[model samples]
Target chain A: MLARDDQPTPPLKRTPLHALHVARGGKMVPFAGYDMPVQFATGVLKEHLHTRAAAGLFDVSHMGQIVLRPKSGTLADAAGALERLVPQDILALAPHRQRYAQFTNDQGGILDDLMVSNFADHLFLVVNAACKAEDEAHLRAALSDTCEIEVLADRALLALQGPQAEAVLSRFCAEAASLRFMDSKPLPVMGLDCFVSRSGYTGEDGFEISVPASAAEQLATALLDQAEVLPIGLGARDSLRLEAGLCLYGHDIDTSTTPVEASLAWSIQKSRRHGGARPGGFAGAEVILDQLDHGAPRSRVGLKPEGRAPVREGAQLYAEADAADPIGQVSSGGFGPSVGGPVAMGYLPAAIAARGGVVFAEVRGQRLPMKIGSPTFVSPSYQR
Target chain B: MTTLFTPDHEWIRVEGDIATIGVTDYAQSQLGDVVFVELPKIGRQLKKAEAAAVVESVKAASDVYAPITGEVLEVNETLQTDPAQVNTDAGGAAWFFKLKIADKAELEGLMDEAAYAAHTA
Candidate 1:
């Protein structure tokens, strides 16, 4: 007997609110092994604008959520185990405060950037939906012998982002109003148990709530019922994050890019730089340390393409004179409705990045002039 | 005043020897957003089903093929600044280009509105 190849098997995973999404006419696409919405019936632009004016609900349950329970000893001792591998001031983290950092290879390149929030109970880890599998494998293989890592499989994550995000969220959790940026606390959302974090990918005031998988749909429905909330899909998410000057994992930053060269030096702590707790002994530490001493080649910068012609991903960036020779390429580029023009971000030589002004991007044999500048095209409205 | 529809959802509005071409409402809705559309240069010759234009959205890129052989007369300049017109009114306002029809016999191969709607459905 042989397996029938006539019908395509359904995708590997499903979100808690999968049925609700199907009911609302979501164009379900297989993304990162989960059946997720690429766009809703209203379309991308409308979804993007809705997130700006009111609260937008995002089903980010596909992202890997983990709980790290430290062995009883000291906070610094437990944080030191992780600090040896990734660069960040995790030990100094106050209970319930969150920190965004990356797991670095020895060469100082980021393996994966993730949100590590220290609650009174455990270290809550939120990793990229695409890189979740690799991240879990690496952590288990790397730290299994030393620390205990528990994969939070039964947990689901949701991001409520926009100007009116706090207003809607405050209705459920009154304690949420005083929570500063990068803060996480276990709060009751509409009588349901969850952890509400005052942070999100979009450059807006928002909360990321992690609830039990069984209760995910009820919570999503409760939030969606408010006139301020609408279901946002991956299309609006990509544009929103891009406009915020935030880096997307696979496209913008990869294992080849060091934190220093990628303009991510802000994530590297001063203590780590001067060898405070545990001298750097991870892979490629020497190269990373050396680069810290001097400067690294190729800095990440934003490009503003003149006119409406979008400079898409993988389009070559070059000096205007010698258009054939490439300087770098666009990692992510698209129309930014808030900026009222096309926006892009990519890597370029440090010299060009330092004296930022204008450069030409080669797209299908035409030289499209682009202005090199800061990543944040629109001012971030995060609740800090 | 003669307009014909292709099975692929392209519309050709024939006026004398020249015919204005664009995608139908069904095609635009299926394609989602219209971010980029590449049009052929004037005086360029094209064959039926040959690459006529390219429309790109956030997720996918599609080629707008010629329904019949013709010479490029004029391309839609409005799409350069406002390609979203295709999403708004794919048939009425977002016409891609006008092509000088090479053979009148090819018009018989196209489907009328009733036939096109049935074919698409």
Candidate 2:
């Protein structure tokens, strides 16, 4: 049945820990079709700073989880089949290791960015919440013949991140402290079976635990009981990721922006590029490889606004204050609590995308000056 | 001295012809944390309901409208450096600006403390 204009809007979905969030004074707001907490009673500023200093618990259960198992009983078969959709060296991924990848369209644009972890005999993928349905359809349509795509709907993802992450997590899962950055494995966390990954969107050292939906509240409650851990909401999550230079699926990297232009060429390994083994088989390989070799026409760069006023997303960028034509636009911008200033990311013509270059951003009918710099506003604290 | 509030969540403390303006405590709680504040220039003429100042939180920026027609007489310069004060003391020390009321008749349109409380409730 077709939806009518007079039909009432569908109600938002709630996570397993929704009740606990409300009990802790979380301010609930609609986000990605889920009724999620934007911040707790302590507020976003304190939550953001707390995550940087101590540990913070984040409910990322809204993201999609999928498993790709090879029908031929070989991990390479599934990795090879999956290579057709992404631009990463999936076959080279070691067992219990995770890597960042992006699903590219035929036009060299990003469909979605995801995390691919190599399990014992299968690949576990974590895709964005907004693009999960389309991603599942794309995977089934293309790789169903060689692999089995299982969508795990009965799971919840929680991120415990910060300097005290290892100290706090080790209390329940002692093996957690042993896994270095990018390591993934099935571990018993708080006596529950879970897929644990030593990776997160925030620059701080952390672990993302994938637990069963039924036991999510139990696990979250036990973790929050720690003195170092506090319930951080979506507001701090956005600012933390932004300060860490991680791209939000729809905002920083979208269908209109390629990985090369988005300054994510580092994620594209040499094995997937020209003259390497198994090169140019994925979608948009020709255009992506061309951008890789000759460089893209425009490049994404970090912006530091000179004033206290934040230069937010969609703010037009200009090279001159009086310029009639705009140069580019900010894709993601906001106040960074750790940096104690405003940080932004936007694309600029490659000719003028040099570090330390000055650009003007139009905010509230006023042209504010900003300096171009490295996108990683804060240094990463990953344990190798 | 008379205190009044507008539907937009701004509170004005009137003493003689000078009126001090700031956002209510409820507004500060909803806005979360105040990271920055942009005030109007002194001597600028503002019409009632006109966008006069800007209050920025970490997530978004909100416009503080003029509660009544007046000329900007002074602004809270302290907010430029320490905007967090708006969160700590929104009703008292975090006054946004002082306006020389151009027309005392505009005060009649504002709600008293009791009406504003009921309106917010």
Candidate 3:
């Protein structure tokens, strides 16, 4: 809960496309210390459905972009150094490939989830906006001797997502259609040098473009001009990712939840596990490896509310309707426009985490029924 | 018959000690899309300013308070299944409930159409 203080709050930072958002009838709100559009004139429901059927352009400039180059002049050294912090097998990451990773604390709890792309000579990373400053400091403190960290503060990130994404982006950058899922490289887009990655959070075939801040508006305007593209806001982005079963940094995975417990063990490569080439070297390896070998006490699972009422985040979960103690709590819950009903994700005791198992969520002093199911509510569409 | 509005954006149509209540068009617009609504039970007594109903949007939930003391005579059950009506026809067919006025004098505090427009402005 946020503190209700009388002190004046700091002024919110604006993205390069702030003016364009305001001009497009975006409803601005404060998010991650930035003034961002929560929804546009099209509203959340339409914007969400539009992204699934067509293409939606989003401005994600608030996220941090960093370039990590090895001081020893070898990408392998940088990858090896990074492997010490994350559980993923970064040493085997091929060129122009991107992998999802998380920064785990000493206790195995997740600090933040990020995407690491192997560029030609350096590693390009995109971290959450809320954790960027701390992530930068953590990197400098841990691997400064092995790598040179360069924070790209003058760049803007844009996501062109959905089924028609490749079609729309190909009009400007013909190379966009050729890149498969998780492929990343430097491509010339509309006369501007950009780092294009064929990956997105919407579970759709899309591309995330990292462009210069000075040319962000021009690129965004050109994309929006396409008949298949519409300007989406943070509201639809959240719903899209939620339905796609993607975890939100602070909400789904936090300082108290480990990757294994969060159902993210798939991201931890076999080489990082016990008896592999490199095993038990990363932070909290003992705890994580134990869970991998055996099982976690509790696990994250998707929830489908039996009724129309949404069981929002922080709602308690119960094993029985009249149970005095809650078995778990919802981390992220909302109306899934694509699902045509309310959907949620939360942790449940492993004993009761079976698929199709019944649980109860207390909403407004009443226990509502929910069904446990796979985390992926919507099937992902990747070029691969 | 007389129509009055509350500062909280509720509208009350009074006729012979009976009041039909719902949210204003301005309120519906501000709420964006209505996904769910919970109405009061019939025959329940409500005091002035008490929470009588709940309207939930895709993002948040809001309370619709009783404008004046009354007893719930009837509720619009259609809202339970078709909540989007609150967004499309909020001031007309989307009336939430009907009340039997307990004190006609309580209606004096509500604003007329012109006064309510100025308040919203």
Candidate 4:
């Protein structure tokens, strides 16, 4: 159970931009052991729409940042070592390119999803904040023999995302505009050295800059000083990523979900697929590959509620006419300001995962009608 | 007519036996970006401190509690088309419903304007 306001609160960690958030009218909340801003004065609705229209500056420093290097100081084959833990083709990942991957357990269930960027010499990794400790331990157990899992505690991460993102970031680093989607480059941003990646959680053309913790505030202030940029909080970040059809670590995916069932087969490259050259060497590859060949029992699908009431997380889903046995449940649901409707994502039986299929979400003892659709409520505008 | 508030942040403006109920401005500000509201049905009995209504914001869903025992008389229909009314004018036109106050003694127990202001403070 979470501690109440008057309760002797556990010490919450603060990010480098914590003070900046408070100065900008951020509503601070305890999130994943960090005192993070859930929203600012603009609120979630406006902040989300603003990010889609212009650019939004997000302080994502709560996410764990780590670098994997050979203990001998020479660049080890970090990708090869990492491939044993995840079912992605890390070895094929070109230098300066980033790939989305997941750490699967023996049963093919996801432990955590992460971003792996090949930095030419070492691998730069980003994992979810809540899962960082376990992820770090897992990495150490899996790859510590070959590479040192160095947690970069001194760096802060910032994401500048939207259509106008390039225009805003170009003021500091002109070379950032040249990077393609999922490309990374080490450059000087506003006099601060940073490793900037042309990617973000929001499915928009943007950049994620990793800066030294001491210089993070200056970089954030400079970016927010731009006309097109506004400081977005975690609330808008959740809604934006939800509308983009991305899975939140603990909510949409967890230890019980596999890549195939989570609708992330695209992340498993062809080289790792069954009958391919590499076939499968990663954890839970047998179950994952089998699910890939023969479909999984359930599939993740998007739901558009019939009425205005949002079908929130944990709301059970049943067939429109039947209420005895629920067919699925809403893993994530909220108002999609851009779509101008209530959008939700959830897992459903493969037979009923048909597009435009009708279902009912049992919310507060009421059966609310909903229609199943593709996971993406809004089409992604990535620069790729 | 006098305005009374519940500890849970709902406000009731009472005129004789009829009372208008809505979440306070502080509550709206805390909720942020009201998107959808599920109003109580007319004639539905609401016990004090019960979940009388559901307000869905951009972030999550919140329950608006009843300050006194009453039967729902009228619901603000404007919220069906535009729920942001709560965020725009929370204590005024965005009132959720009208209730026939069940007991005058229950109203006496609620916090007055000065008490509410300090309670929220």
Pick out the ten consecutive residues of candidate 2 chain A with the lowest summed lDDT. Answer: A1-10
User: What is the C-alpha lDDT profile of model 4 across B1-121, one tens digit per residue?
Assistant: 7788887888899998999999999998888899999999999999988888999888878888888899999999999899999999989999999989898789878888999899879
Could you tell me how far off, in angstroms, the CA of residue A277 lies in candidate 2 after the best superposition?
1.1
lDDT by residue (A1-384, candidate 1, tens digit) is 001237686656998878888888888878878889988997887788789888899999999898776666445555666776687777777899998888888767888899988876567789998888888888888766556788888888999999998999888889888888889988888878899999998888899999999999889989999999999998889888999999999888989998777778787767677555644555557767777778888888999997667788898899774666889889899877677668899999999999998888886667889999988887889878
In model 1, which runs have C-alpha deviations exceeding 4 angstroms? A1-10, A275-282, B58-60
Query: Best by lDDT, which number?
Result: 2
lDDT of 3 by residue, B1-121 (tens): 7789999899999989899999999898887778888899999999999999988877777889999999999999999999999999999999999999999999999999999999889
List where candidate 3 sits over 4 angstroms from the true fold.
A1-8
DockQ ranking, high to low: 4, 2, 3, 1
Error of 1 at A371 (Å): 1.2
The candidates' interface RMSDs, in order, read: 10.1, 10.1, 5.6, 4.6
Q: TM-score-based ranking, best first? A: 2, 3, 4, 1
Docking class of 2: acceptable
- Encode model 3's per-residue lDDT on A1-384: one tens digit a residue: 011237676899999999999999999988899999999989888999999999999999999999999999999999998898899988899999999999998899998899999996899999999999999998999899999999999999999999999999999998998999999999989979999999999988999999999999999999999999999999899989999999999999998999999999999999999889999788888899999999999999999999999888899999999999999999899888899889899999988996458899998888999999977899999899
Clashes of 3: 0
Which one wins on TM-score? 2
Clash count per candidate? 3, 0, 0, 0
iRMSD, model 2, in Å: 10.1
* Global local distance difference test of model 2: 0.93
